[model samples]
Target: MRAALAATGRVVRAETFRLLRKRRMYVLAALWWVVLPVLVLLLARVLQVTLTGSFVEGEAVSVKTLLQGLASPFGVARVGLVAPAYLSPSPYVIAVALLAAAGLGEPRTHRMWKSTLVAEPDRRAVLAGTFLTMQAFLGVLLAGAFVFGAAFGAIGTTFLPTAAEGAWGRLAGLYLLQWAHLATLLAFASLAIFVLRNVTLGVVTTFFLPPLVEGLYAVWRATAGFEPLNRFNALFQGLELQATLEAVPRWFLSNNLYLPARTSAAPLLDEVVGTLQAVGEEAGGGPGGAQIASLLGADLTLPHAGLVMAVYGAIFVTLLVVAFLRREVA
Candidate 1:
C-alpha cells in the first residue's frame, strides 16, 4: 500500500510539473482567468454609461448585478440589445477547446504515456495522475473566478444596484456550471485522442467541428423537430456563461430598477407564474386566459441547468476512464 501511494504521488507530481512547463497553459489561464472577466465588466459598465447618461449603480454590486444591469437597460440607454452580442459563448468554447486538446491529446502527441508506463507500468496509476492534475488545474481556475467575481462585484457597488437572493444563487450556479462545461470539453477531447491518436487534428476538430455542428444541428432540429438532438443542445447551452442569464427572470424593465415591486413573494412563485404563462400561450390560449391562469399556477423549478451539465460530465469522465484503460499506449 505504501509503495502504491508513493508511485501515485510521483505520477501526480510528474504530470503537474509537465503541464506547468507548457507556456500555452499560462497564456490560456491568464486570458480566461483574468482578462475575459475584466473585459466583460468594462463592457457592461460602458453600456450602462452610454444608455442612462450615467452608470447604473448597485447598492452592493455583484457579478450578477453588473450582468443584469447590462441585460436590461433604461430609457435613452436602450442599446441593451447589444448586450447579448458582447456576452458571447465564444470565449469559453475556445478556452475549453484548448484545454481539451492539452489535457487529453497531449499525452498522445508527445508519447509521454509510453515512457511513464515503463516506469510505473500501472495503467490506472497513469490515468489517476492525469485526472488529478486536471482536477488541481480546475480548482485553481475556479478559485480565481471566485476572487475575480468578488473584486468585480465590489467595484460595481459604486453604481447603486438592487440586490436579491436569486442573484447570489445564480452566482453559485455559474461556478458549478464551469466544472460541467470543462468536463464535457475534456470528455470529447479525450474521445478524439482515443480515436485519432494525434493532438493537432484531435484538438482542431474538438474545437472547430462543434460550432459548425451546433449551427447545422440547431437548424435541422428546428425544422425537423428532432427530440434527441435537443437534449444535446443542452450540453452546448450549459457551457455558455450567458446560459444563466437566459434561465434567470428578467422581471422588470431597466428604468424601473429603483422602484421596488411586490417581490416579497418567493422566487418559486414567480417562476411558476412565468412557466404557466409560457405553456398557456403555446396551448393557444388568449392573453386573458394566460393572465388569469398564471396567477393560479406554481413555479415548477427543477435541478438547475448546471446539474444537466454535471450529468454530461459524469458520462464524459466515465468514457475517458474506459478509453484510457482499454487502449494500449502505442
Candidate 2:
C-alpha cells in the first residue's frame, strides 16, 4: 500500500511538472487570469458609458458603482458565494476539452506514451495520476477566476451585499455541481483523444458535438412535440437544474447582470414565470411530464442530472482505461 501510494504521488508530481513546462499552459493561464479580466472590465466600462453616459470629464464615479458595473462582465451577481454569471458550464467545458486534447493527445502524437508506460508500468496508476493532476490544474484555474472576480468586486465597489440566507449551503452544492460538470467533460475528452489519437479531432468534437446534438434534438422536439431529448443534453441539464434549484432568485440575479435594465418589464420575464408555473402544475403528472416540468424551473432535482453526468464520466474513463491497457504501446 505504501509503495502504491508513493508511485501514485510520483506520477502525479511528474505529470504536473510536465504540464507546467508546456508554454501553451502558461499562455492559457495568462489569458484566463489577466487578459480575460481586463477585457471584461473594459467592456463593462464601455457599456456603462454608452448606457448611462455617466463618464463625464470631471465627474467622480464611486468605486462602488464601478464595481457594480464590473459585476456583469465578471459573472459576479449578488454578494453571495454564488456567482450567477460564472455558473454557466461553457467555461468549464472549454477549459477541460482544450486541456485534455493537448495533454492526452500530445502524448500519442509525439509517441511519448510508450516511455511513460515503461517508466510507470502501472498504466492505471499513471492514468489516475494524470487525471488527478488535470483536476487540480482545473481547480486552480476556476479558483483564480473566482478570485479575480472577487477582487474586481472588492476594488470597484465599496459595498458588498450579504449573501442571502442559506446561500452558504447552496454555494457548497454549487461548487460540487460545477466540479462534476467539468469532470464529466474532461473524462469525455480524455476518452475521445485516447481512442482517436488525435487532439484536434477530440477538441473539435468536444466543442461542437454537444451543441450540434442539442440543436438537432431541439428540432426534433419542435416537430414531434416531445421533450425527452432535453434530458440528454449536459449543458441544458446543468443550466436547467441550476435554474430549477435557484428558481426566481437565480433568474432575477442572472437577468439583472446580463440583460439591459430596461428589459425588466419585458415579456421574457413573464414567459419564464409562466413556464415555471406550468412546470409546477405538471409535476408528478408522469415521468415525461415530470421531466418536462423540471425543465421549466431551476430543476431542484439536480441529482438526476448529476447522475447522468457521472455515468458519462464513468463510462468514458472506463473505456479509456480498458483501451489503454489492451493497446500495444510501441
Best by TM-score: 2
TM-score of each: 0.59, 0.67
Error of 2 at 66 (Å): 11
- The root-mean-square deviation over C-alpha atoms between each candidate and the true structure, in angstroms, is 11.4, 9.7
Off by over 4 Å in 1: 1-6, 53-89, 155-170, 208-217, 225-311
lDDT score, candidate 2, position 113? 88
Residue 216 displacement (Å), model 2 = 2.1
Please, what are the lDDT tens digits per residue for candidate 2 over residues 1-330?
Answer: 677677789888998888888777677667666666555556655655555545542376654454453443233422212322234544555678768866688788889988888998887788888888888887777666556655554443333321112233444445545655567678878887788777888887876676565555445544543335555455666666533532322222112222221122234445665665676667844334334433332333345455556666778788988987888876
Error of 2 at 210 (Å): 2.7
| lDDT (0 to 1) per candidate | 0.51, 0.58
lDDT value, residue 102 of candidate 1: 64
lDDT of candidate 1 over 36-142, digit per residue (tens): 55565577666555544334343334444445543222200111112211234444445555665666677667776677678887777767677667666765655
Q: Kindly provide the TM-score of model 2 when superposed on the true structure, using C-alpha atoms.
A: 0.67
Model 2: residues with Cα > 4 Å off, grouped in runs: 47-89, 158-173, 225-300
